[model samples]
Target: MKSGVTNLFVTVIGLAAALVPVNSFAALGDLYEADFFSHTIFKFTPAGTKSTFASGQSLSEDLAFDRFGNLFEADGGSGTIFKFTPAGTKTTFASGLSGPFGLAFDAAGNLFVADASSGTIFKFTPAGSKSTFASGLSIPNGLAFDRSGNLFEADDQSGTIFKFTPTGSKSTFASGLSFPVGLAFDGAGNLFATDQSGTIFKFTPAGIKSTFASGLSSPDGLAFDSAGNLFEADFSSGTIFKFTPAGSKSTFASGVGNPVGLAFEPATGIVADISTRASVQTGNQVLIAGFILTGTDPKQVIVRALGPTLTSFGVANALQNPVLELHNSTSVIATNDDWQSAANANQIPTSPVDYRPPDSRESAILITLQPGAYTAIMSGKNSTTGNALVEVYDLATSTFSQLTNVSTRGFVGPG
Candidate 1:
């Protein structure tokens, strides 16, 4: 259903657990979760296989990762932060801190932590020597860095988000939060903060805030997985929840007492869809979505235009009948009106690659393409109009080109 079910849910099953070859690095990809009350840590594979990553901790509140794949945890009760290697060996990364709650690593390999009790932020070298980075905060709990290397802190006491320059100059980025406790950033530079009041706020780089999500119960830590899904540690529910960039959430892990923090395995991200513009148009409007495939092998994707199905989702005046025309730039390569009418329609026998359209009226195309720029145009059938959804799903990761833009230049006039 276009309502939500299109995202990649990586439980510890099948392809999610299978190794992703990231160029030359043999990465041991695992999801690390910290249990504060039980004083232990658990690791889950992408498909949900659970195991102990580390244990024997004292109120560990958060976790971070370095470029080398090592993990660091902030022990609020012990007042020290510990670093753990891939081999599960722990070393005192920095000591004599005041309830270190949040941890982050800068681009230069230096580690930073929010000293919650002292209302200060600390920086440490790769060798573990510590120094004060910024001071005079009110219970700074959550720490994160933007793409520009600027650091941000979520203050639980003052309920504000503070921005710090690379040289440690501090400014109030956002204020008037309801006990802001966890901070995270999406790939688009939008910042997300979780509050004790059960809402997650999203802020642009310009600091304009909006509600990204709500109904969370005491979410205390935030971490984004390799696929860009945000995972939150819910202290009250004792569960870990995963949210898509659009803010639809599902349970990822549960039953551990007071889960406080999580970390995803590190990988370089290749962006999917450089630009996307979605809207409702009138008449027989042709919405063009273009992408340029690279590499030599053929790529597969599920291309579809949704209209009648949108009414089930509360969409008003949705295009009663929609048509899809795929182009290799200027020439039409494929056209479809009803998905079930295609010769190979419903031919996909299994899934993670399923292309079956349940509604006979929906238009879909399962295409195998080569290295070139192509476009998909969504239009109404015979002057029909209003609104609809045009979507493309990659069946084989980045094997296909990323969608460049979804837009329309030729407006449909009254027929």
Candidate 2:
């Protein structure tokens, strides 16, 4: 009888563990800023904590991390490249250039520096030997590399993108940009860049240029998240804007002071790098969550939940009904009431939803889920087909696990 009780207890514990929700873990590193005037590099953690990385430099414009995790800063005013270890040991890696603005690393771990004043792109080895990779033309400010090792540089003076081959041959990939400064490439090989005139542009590998986003004060630096969303640093307004691949723009962070350089730390998974022109440290980490739902009668679907903490809820419809829930994990959190309303108003369809429509015909829903483990219930009835499906996304991992399908009635929690 005791052995039988032990078996039943084990089974119940296993079932309870299966019902518990699993959260995707994300560690957001703080944003560090190297003030040009103060000549200091300040590091900010996600919890609004601050530390000094390095100090006593001259006009640091851009920063890049090496394979060994050492930070490299472009001191445009001094025409030098400052290299610092993670613990803040600073040294001059290279010097005596003519206004190096942006820096990037190639696949082979070579450093490419963009000299804006000389319109030149210089390549430097880890040993500090510098050579002119490409020269002559307009103000080259930002540098990026594609998967195939081709280099793309953004010219602020010409508002054009120059493609440099490994053999040093250069060609204009796209033209008619507005003082483009920062350049970045997405997973699809599409190039995204920001201009001083407050516009973002996207270029295909085939040389097709299109305006991806616009109407900013002065977009200086550009970066991408794991979800393919584009982020732009606005120098004029000291704000950071997040843009969807479809050209939709939203304010990611604001109240920055002369924000210029932007880089995403993939290890931390945050969007903004947030370096200002001055010395006061101010930065924060913004968490983003995404959800996708599909079914034949999604319009009849709804998500209901009583959180473990139960703060608020909302939703959005990137394609169909996208619901968001917010809970008070601590004493108080940011206002997430709008997200809850958005969730309640959004509804899913009853048919299969395709992310890429037409042949597949799937619908997608996006919502922000606050931190905590809670029970989420999705329910809908399709009168015509009697088929419904739901999917949950853990945005931090960039992984998608299907929760329910045609034969499933509803999802109690996570799988």
Best by lDDT: 1
List candidate 2 segments past 4 Å from native.
1-52, 244-248, 266-415
Using alpha carbons, what is the TM-score of model 1? 0.59
Name the weakest run of 10 consecutive residues (lDDT summed) in model 1: 8-17
**Each prediction's TM-score versus the true structure:** 0.59, 0.56
Alpha-carbon local distance difference test for all models: 0.72, 0.54
- Predicted candidate 2 versus true structure: per-residue lDDT over 113-151, tens digit per residue: 999888788999756778989888688898887756688
Q: After superposition, how far is residue 150 of candidate 2 from its true place, in Å?
A: 0.4
The candidate that achieves the highest TM-score relative to the unseen native structure:
1
Superposed on all Cα atoms, the candidates' RMSDs to the truth, in angstroms, are 18.6, 19.4
Model 1 CA lDDT for position 263: 79
lDDT of 2: 0.54
Tens digits of per-residue lDDT for model 1 on 65-126? Answer: 77456789998889988888878999987788889899887655568999988988888876
Candidate 1 Cα lDDT to native: 0.72
